[model samples]
Target: MDNQRSLWAAWAERLRQRFSFILQGQCALCDRPTSQVFCQDCTRRLQACRVQSSVLQIAGLPPLYSWGYYEGALKQSLARLKYGGRPQVAEPLGQWLAQVWLDSGLLERGLVVVPIPLHGDRQQQRGYNQAELIARSFCEVTGMPLRARGLIRTQPTTAQYGLLRLERYQNLSNVFQVGAALQKSPNLKDIVLVDDIFTTGATLKSATETLQQSGFRVVALFTAALSERQIA
Candidate 1:
């Protein structure tokens, strides 16, 4: 009976491996055979391309820190996450952002991770807030608490893509407000605003101003990718 059980276990393991190989798909970036969305080699290369600058200065807003520029593998991965219905991509990407946050030494300040919120209609349409997903994963990896509802989007606005710099700011104006729970939480002070991408600093600036007006200090903006123009 013992020998039979051992043989059966071995056979089951073999079958599981075979099935896993069958199910494993190509890497999202390189098209190489990988069980994960991004293979190990591609992931390392992506990490290597990350921005060495830990501080990004934007007028009237907290400094931003991004993992990499929005291009190549990073851009492709984010596009899939945002528009391709591949929400699972947020995990590894968020982990990378979390690592950046950890290395930046701001984690010692007891900062709360707050993701920029999506309006009810838009969020419902998309079925998920990508920022929230990234923030959740960030907290999981860093062991920091995430205040997912710290901010609320009271109104929906036009998408910022292709909009001029001034237009982007105007579009987001009066769009975000502090959530009631965060308002009532007296202990909450410092925050790290998490977003998927930083384009022109408009969205983050608006969110920062709103939070600051509400008596919270935004320590920094954390994002997965930053546009080339914004990098300068």
Candidate 2:
């Protein structure tokens, strides 16, 4: 039985290798023949965005930790993953994000990773929640268990594309809702809200307020990057 299992495992590994080579022809950014989803050149070019990993607590809002400003290759990558329905993109990018947190010596004590939940309708429309994918990958890399329950968007929100700055905040003010099944061993007494981007900090603020009201002491907000379209 063990011998048979090893043979199957080896075959699976070979299959995966072949599949990867088949799927990956050229770097999306540089058109290089690299195993990396994004070529090394593109990865290095994305380093222009760097923000302090330390905590920044907002009044009446949870402490926020933005990886950096979203630009260059990051914008393209996120667009591909978010709008283009690319799940594979989350693997490399999310792993890099976890490494950034680990190298920074963050992901502190009593850490819980709660992805910002998408509205059910929106999630269905998108086919998957990009933030959830990143959070799942982050958990796999960090060994931190993920909690996606009880936190949800109560309803669909209007498009934020051209909304005024003030309107954006107002639109998301009461968008999220705490799930009734907030009961769990690792309840959100201490958690880090995960998301793909932080624009006006409005979404984080709103989610923070809801969690705190539910007595979950949300300590931090972690986003892959910050949105450049933030209202001035």
Whole-model lDDT values for every prediction: 0.87, 0.75
Candidate 2, pairs of clashing residues: 150-179
Off by over 4 Å in 1: 1-17, 23-33
Clashing pairs in 1: none
**Local accuracy of candidate 2 as per-residue lDDT tens digits, 1-232:** 9999999999999999888877777665556777777777877876666554434555666656666678877777788888876677777666766876686666577677788888898899999888888888888998876777657899788876678879888889888877644556444477778888877777778888888877787766778887655312
Counted clashes in each candidate structure: 0, 1
Clashes of 1: 0
RMSD of each: 3.8, 7.6
Return the TM-score for each candidate structure. Answer: 0.87, 0.79
What does candidate 1 score on TM?
A: 0.87
